[model samples]
Target: MEAPSFLDFIIHVTGLPGYLVFSWFMILVIISLALIVRSSLKLMPEGIQNVAESVVYGIYSFVEDILGKEETPKHFPLLATLAIVIFFYNIVELIPGFIPPTSNLNTTLSMALIVFLYYQFLGFKRHGIKYIKHFMGPVWWLVPLILPIEIIGHFARIVSLSVRLFGNIFGDDLLLAVVFFLAPWLVPLPVMALVLLAASIQAFIFFLLSTLYIADAINEAH
Candidate 1:
């Protein structure tokens, strides 16, 4: 057999969009969550039940710290779901041969758009007609100037969140691929450790930003 050219190798490796695995992973997460919920309903809390409760409590506390007691219960479910889903999506990249769903721009952008729409919906729901005032600045005179800036800033968050997440995961994925290809044995372990740390930090950052956005929508002045 003839040796493959460098261009051919690059084309072969980079041709696919690489999203089927993400879809499968998402299905797995949903089923796992369902099973976990079912298991947690036992008379006495044990194993998965205990773990689920602990995780729930921690998420609730985190939400309470940001949104206060009144809103914690209301927002906990969405926040917890986002935190867990994103965390899992990110950490999946650490497993050999598994690409994190979040490494894809489409996946990250969809998540970002979801958060964007959610906060906007919450703001309008909480503030009603008054939510429009949020873009109007402190005084009426600055409405023209402030409105555009505020609108841009809000949309910018979607791009920021999506791009930030996708860029980090994609870069990490590429770096790991290169390192593993080069060493394939010893050095990849330490690099894998770094990937794990980066994955965790990215997940936490996403969750934290999400919490802050929700809190802002619910509590900030119009």
Candidate 2:
């Protein structure tokens, strides 16, 4: 018996060998980042400290843009946690002989499911049973048509979130595979750089879209 693997970067779907190596890579990367950030905490700003501070401030500004001031801090922890975890999972793909945890549908779908549960939960908290009214749309008569659309739309979010991440990372791994197959050394160097860029951007997109979905589920709709 073996662990499952989808989107084999090597052969067709038929091949997906030992993935525990990739899993361990993901864990180690996360622990190392945690340790580094933990030890680097400083009261006074230094050179790279200013850079880090600026990045954190920038993330806050971005969150405030999507969530507004009153509620921005409410979701900050969730947002930050998702961003950190996804980014770590993605960056781990860079290590030799490793696959990104996020590159798997199960892993990515789990994260998307988490987002789905959270928004639905919050909607219930905010609107109670009235949240169901959201699906009926503003016009009562339209509920018949709109209900299915809304339901499908919600499910689509989960699919989109998971697939988008899995597709990008898996494609990244595939592209690298090609590069390695062709030249195996310095040729894939450029691909590795592109992977880094794509990984970060994908993580950012995941965070931004998650914020939008949560906000939409509860917003007043001005």
For residues 1-222, write the lDDT of model 1, one tens digit per residue.
111254234436767445544545566876788687885698777877777888878888988988899988887887788777877787776666666788989988988998999999999999998888888899999999999999999999999999998899899888877877787786456888888888888877888898899888877684
lDDT of each: 0.80, 0.79
Best by lDDT: 1
**Highest TM-score, which number?**
1
Q: Pairing residues by index, what is the TM-score of model 2?
A: 0.83
- Put down candidate 2 lDDT per residue, 75-104, tens digits, no spaces: 887887788778878887676556677878
> TM-score of predicted model 1?
0.84
Clashes of each: 0, 0
The candidate 2 region of ten consecutive residues with least summed lDDT is 1-10
Q: Deviation in angstroms for 114 in model 2?
A: 0.1
